[model samples]
Target: MKLLIVGATGTLGRQIARHALDKGYNVRCLVRNARKASFLKEWGAELVIGNLCKPETLLPALEGMEAIIDAASARATDAIKQVDWEGKVNLIQAAQKTGVNRYIFFSILNAEKHTDVPLMEIKHCTELFLAESGLNYTILRPSGFMQGLISQYAVPILDNQAVWITGASSAIAYMDTQDMAKFAIRALEVPETKNQTYPVVGTKAWTAEEIIQLCEKLSDKTAKISRIPLGLLRFLRGFTHFFQWTYNISERLAFAEVLASGKALTAPMEQVYEIFGLDSKETTTLESYLKEYFSRILKKLKELDYEKSKSKKKKKTPFKSSV
Candidate 1:
């Protein structure tokens, strides 16, 4: 099948593109940068240069395509509206005009149910638009990304000896981006997935404290975990907003509410395994992933230290004073 992947340069989008190619689908990547497209070309994907803001540019790339997977946009409210809502609307129009059969979208879990959050609201709105667009559509609402945990949680603990978190007790199902990509690819290939919304998540759920404990066990270091209250997090959100960082206050508040409720994960791993044909039983525990992550980080830090030492020695000339 011929497939066009929007946001193909992003972390998740790239994975989905690669997996689609591996599955023997003809893949076209819609990318904003030619340089980014160069790498994707090396990965065996045809590149189409276009921005999500300009829907007209998408038509040529999307023409005669069997499916379009939208993984673009930031997680913020404004970015979501611009890219997820507007851009997706444009893509739907183009797809209909170009005779595309299926439209698959990557969305966040609980977006429809959680109306109080700005990000979720944007997602909900986009889903509504897709429903009324008269196109065959599948919406995949994936849980928190495991890759995000590595970047947002584990790296901090490894580098700073602590995991500072906004919502401490929130139990979120985290999915490996690779797994999510595989699921998306499978959904695209299967006709049963059309006109459906699937909640995709990892094999298990983990709280912030539990995650930190697991990381500590893996790294064999007692790292501190600092928890910020909802109000304090709200303040920090304001500070981040002042710098124009792409975070929404309402979303943060919604996250706080989720934590306060102490709810378990709603997505089932068995469904993921059944769909993707992987033994989803093999868990990516927080401990195992963090151990591997920190090992590489420590190696890089050591390399940097060696480089710094060598530079210092080189700077110490014969005339230079030895302290």
Candidate 2:
């Protein structure tokens, strides 16, 4: 299949392109700067110049595409309405106009529950828009990425910095981007997955406290934890909500109340697994993932320490060279 992957430079998008290419699909990455995305070209993907914010530049790129995997979202520096809302709608329209067979959209888990959150609301809206666009679409709503947890929890705990978490008892079934990419590319071949929405989360759900403990066990380093009260997030959201310039700041606090609902961001994966022809056991778990990360980082740190000590010893020793 000829695939057009939008946001191909992003974490999830790159994984999708890799998986699709590996599956013998001809992959074309619609990137803003071909030079910046030259790595995709090296990986056997054809790179095309296109910007989501420029709707006029989308159609020619979408032309002759068999399928589209849209993983694009607004960055912290981007205007929320331009990219997430208008840009996405235009892309969907172009795909429909160009007769793209399958459309796969990556969305957030339980986005409807967080309507006040700018990105979540945009994702939910885009889901609805794609559903109504008269196209064969599959919406994969994945929970948090385990990759993100590396910096959020692992690095901080390892570096002995304050790992911030809300006081809410919220647990998330974080999925690996690589595994999630499998479900996405597999959706192209699964007839039943067309026009269906699946919550593609990990095998196990983990809370903030549980993850901290896991990091502690794996890295053997205690985490200096700081809890931000949900009330404070709510207050900040209210303070920033009405300001036009504070949308970016508001995005940070938007999910605060949603997660505080005492809900686990997880769903039954039995059906999703069966539909996507994926094994639940093969999914990466929080424990194994964290263990691998901490092991690698700690080893690197130890190697650095050894090198530093070795250099110090060399400097301390009088020149033993025959002079």
Candidate 3:
């Protein structure tokens, strides 16, 4: 089957493309940057340059495509509406016009119920639109991405320092991007998944504090986690508003609510495994993923240090006679 993968250059998108290629499917990646598209080409994917913001660019790419997996969107609420809602609408219209059969959408868990968060609310709107779009569709509402947590928490731990987080006690379900990609591929293959909304998560749930402890154990470092106060979180939310145009009032309010109410725990990982036969072994524990993520960060830090030292040596050199 032929497929079009939007946002194929991103973290999750890259994994999805690799998984699709492994399945021996003909994959076409719709990307904005040619350099990023080249990487997918090296991975054996046909690269198609397009922009989700401009629907006109997508119609040519959508031609002769059987399915479209939309991983494109702005994580902030304001951007979500513009890109997720409006972009999805544009793609659906183009798909309908082009006679595309299936559209797989990546949505966030608790989007409908969590109206206070701007991003979730916008996603909810997109889900609602898809439900009424009169097209065969599958929606996967994944909880917080496991990678997001690792990036947020593991950096400080690896540096032998504490990390400050808002909701340390909330036990949220996290899913690896690989697992989510497997589910997406399954949704593309399984007829039963069409017209349904599935929640994708990991085999277990973990609190932020627990995750911090796990990082400490994995790296053999003693790291403390300090919970930022609600008031401080609210202030930071507002502060972010000044700098973030697409993620303003609603997004800030939603972030504050998530921290205050601990709205992270909602989905279970069992359903994902049951539907796709994706065993728990496929999902790496938080500690394992964090170890690798931290290692990369440390490597970059070392490179930066080397560059600084080279610059210092050059500066220390006596001025040569440059006749």
Instruction: Candidate 3: give the clashing pairs.
Output: 117-254
Q: CA lDDT, every prediction?
A: 0.76, 0.89, 0.79
Q: Tell me the lDDT of candidate 3.
A: 0.79
Candidate 2 accuracy as TM-score = 0.95
Which residue pairs show backbone clashes in model 2?
A: none
Q: What shift in Å separates residue 40 of candidate 1 from its native position after superposition? A: 0.8
How far is 227's C-alpha from truth in model 3 (Å)? 2.9
lDDT of 2 by residue, 1-323 (tens): 99999999988899999999999999999998888899899999999899988889999998889999998877778887889899999999899889999999999999998887878898999999999999999999987889989989988987889999888858889989999899989999999988899998998888989999999999888999898888888889889979979977787667666766679999999988987888888988888888888889889999999999999887855567786
lDDT of 2 at 72: 81
| Candidate whose TM-score is highest | 2
For residues 37-146, could you state the per-residue lDDT of candidate 1 as single tens digits? 78789989998888777987988988778889898866444455577677877888898899888888887787777776666777888888887888899888876777
Task: Please give the range of 10 consecutive residues that has the lowest summed lDDT in model 2.
Answer: 252-261
Q: After TM-score superposition, what is the CA distance of residue 90 in candidate 3 from its true location, in Å? A: 1.2
